[model samples]
Target: MKRKSLIITLLILGSILFANGWDVQEYPYDLYVYYIVTKAPEKYENLIGSSVVAVTSHRHGDFGNAFNSSCKSGVIEFLENEDFVIDKMDGIDSTFLSKSFIEKYFPEVLCADISVSKEDLSYIWENLSSKYVGFSDMKKRGLNKKKFNKIKNTSELKALFDKYMEDCHFDMKIREFTYYQETAYDEGCKKSKDQRDIYFEQETSNAYYVRFTSCVEANANYFTNLEAVGVIGRNKEFIILDARSNYGGSNYVQEKLQKILNLEKYKGTVIVLQDNWSTSSGEVWSIFGNEKSQFKTLLVGTHSGGMQNYDRSNTIKNDDLNIEISFGSKYLGKILPKNYLGEGKGYEPDIWATTETMASVLTGLGVDVTGITFQ
Candidate 1:
């Protein structure tokens, strides 16, 4: 009777603590262990059973050393207790715990509309860990192993989402609205010459100029239309692609240009004008134009904006620290060659053209660039 009574009391206490949630500063190890096993994405599902404790120790140790040196003492002790190697915790960014990851693995969590902010996540971690006896007996409730395979395409995914949206009445953001805007821009660029900055010098009869402001689908369509109208054909001796101040968008436009135009057929000088504002997709396009073009494409103007590697990021709210942690998951490769670090060091120019000298450079090619603005 005494043993039974003690067990009951402990169970009640555990329930209460679970409802309250964890204080990460006080119970960091407990919180970390709970999240890494239960809440982390399926991609990291390998980190579930036996490796949970080690993974938790590794992440916490990394976090502690980087952000708070005071926690390093406690974190070190925890790692040692777990039999985890301290050296293995080197390159982990534990600040912004994966939000997209959770969404991908557990879409059901979205139906609850729970505000899982930094404070909320901490509270959840505390609550979950408080009631936890052992991982062996943990309930694997709603995690469907074949969730991704169920919906093969976007249409099927949309159908499933529609059912959920109707049942939940969740306020969905208009993400597809940009598609309509892109369509309108495409139509305008194709129909009206004034809509886009594309010109062929009839006086020189040998120079074709196109100042693409952005590397978008619309600009690609406009360039295609220009090609159809005989504006960028074999008649030209020189082609000036002014992408100066273009801060990038999609590289599909560049790909389309290479495909439809077949730049090699027109054995003219392909000059690409770029500046500090030419970045991201713009830099990518410049690199593609230089490498893919059979006729070596000349990169004119100053160095481009060097931000190369493309990655999708999620902003996680850290209320405790009063800062937002933007965590990037996927690492899309650099635009330039392996030697160049495109973050700070952009692509070097073959013929350097500044704001003052650009007009003269164009004029030297027997093409007047008086009214033409660097788009």
Candidate 2:
């Protein structure tokens, strides 16, 4: 029990230390995991009777066309230097895209054509609460799986969604929303309210640090509220990277943010406080060694979730609902590497700290964080 208390004390202290301005850089580890993704168009058949279609994106199509050519294969031989590794992926957020085109492609079929009610087809997605009745549930309900087998093509699937929407008063909640324009990387960030006055005096640098506790489950809630979060810049001062929650957003967004922060060689600490829940983008941004700069990254928390998920596209056909399926495909080899010190563990922390340690570290700083808060 005493040992456990000691661990917690260190983490709390570490957090406080960061609230003040000090940098004790550390190393990151690598681990292996993979995610899958899929995409496709809806058809009338899928809606009326039932069917499942595997999907791909324009990215795969273009790349396959280019890479499949014998000439492209020859280029691969030359490019396969010992240091070179190939990994390509993009475009998987929510599946919903649009409905009109789906209907145009797929018209209603004879009632004899399919089984899953238009009600069962889309109700779960429209009302997130009805999720238990989702396609997965329909099979358990003993209605949907049997119905989908009859869906001969994508067009039929499309008609079903159109009718489903009209019947259940279901509007695609995702369709109406537009994604905000991503902020440019060069733009400065603002210090959070909690950090100021209590932590360090406001300081500015082109170099930046963002400490975080990666929580994959956070995505289930965080991504849903992204727009409301909005862009935050430093107050009446110059900060390069903002520290909001520090531990959210999809891996794709974080990957983009990492490259953006990599502008001009950075010499400062980019601390990310991680726990086992630190996954997806958290893992990628924490230990991506591809960058040229020697990042003064501090991993002061526990072993990070070293799961790296690669996505394979899944597309829905014959439905007005514009959702593409994404499932786990292959695992990217471990970014969280094993060492003589430890193996099959989470990412290593250079300046390891527990929650209690973090508290003490902050206490030692004797900061006057006027603008920061603990809650």
Candidate 3:
């Protein structure tokens, strides 16, 4: 009776500590500033006494529901209270490039098939082009201030933006909604229906393959699946981790994997397969295999989606705005500089290969490919 009572009390305390969402009082926007100041305060050490809004503008995806007008107003108010400057003309200038304005006047820009007049183009260039060109991905794509400022017309801007969009693996857009569909590297090899989150099989006598479809903490089999892989592949010469198209979930998965996969005892190479589709926690897993694991690790396939720089994401709700903003509590730049593949920049692999050519690539690396199929 006493044990049952203790368990119930603990459960209640846990629920209270981790409520559905953080109340408005526990504002994550402010907490993000505190975290940057205390935890990862290398380059951002000056932020200790600086205004929160200074750092906020430089970050991307810090606020989850940024489109909500009420939320935006609340955020602006919060920044203003913290002595952050807000130009009164900002709203007026941005009104011309808003979603409603674009839909009504320049709908063709939505489809990237628009040819606007010089006056309209110049207006857009003055208002939106600076922000777009300032994007990290755009800068990485060789779009510099000199080149962008020199552009005289809409055609050049469109051409540059289009090319950047095409070449950039990670979606980077200004005030535009982008959706990514996770795709499996090998569609023919269907995952076992019984084992949905993780699937493992001995591809060869010396090699074992494990595919992680999702890393969501809610998946009951996450830990067990990883434990099973550790037990089964203890003596295997090679362990292949396929994380293609895995758009990460919980860091709990990373913790569980670290404990289960005892790389120190296992004398074998761990090969992680990743692509541009593998992001966030998926990239975290790949980084663990390559940088954290005690075993010999090799990162294969193309660059991994770079979205693991920030972690410990928590949602904070604002009752006034009726909005929940999810923001990361920790910045990983100082902690994991090697894996700190910035926004829209993926982790480059040691061996780059596609799904079609992976087998040949591995074989060339002295990994036995006899009777080993990708499926």
Candidate number achieving the greatest TM-score relative to the actual structure: 3
Model 2, span 170-246: residue lDDT tens: 11212221111111111111111121111122232322222232224533433332221112211212122222223
Candidate 1 lDDT by residue in tens digits, 271-308: 77766545556564444454555654667776665545
User: How many clashing residue pairs appear in each of the predictions shown?
Assistant: 2, 107, 0
Error at 259, model 3, angstroms: 4.6
After aligning candidate 2 to the native by TM-score, how far in Å is the CA of 363 from where it should be?
6.7
Two-way lDDT contest, 1 vs 2, winner? 1
Q: Over the full model, what C-alpha lDDT does candidate 2 score relative to the true structure? A: 0.30
Q: Which candidate's lDDT is highest?
A: 3
- TM-scores across all candidates? 0.41, 0.31, 0.46
TM-score of 3: 0.46
Error of 2 at 10 (Å): 37
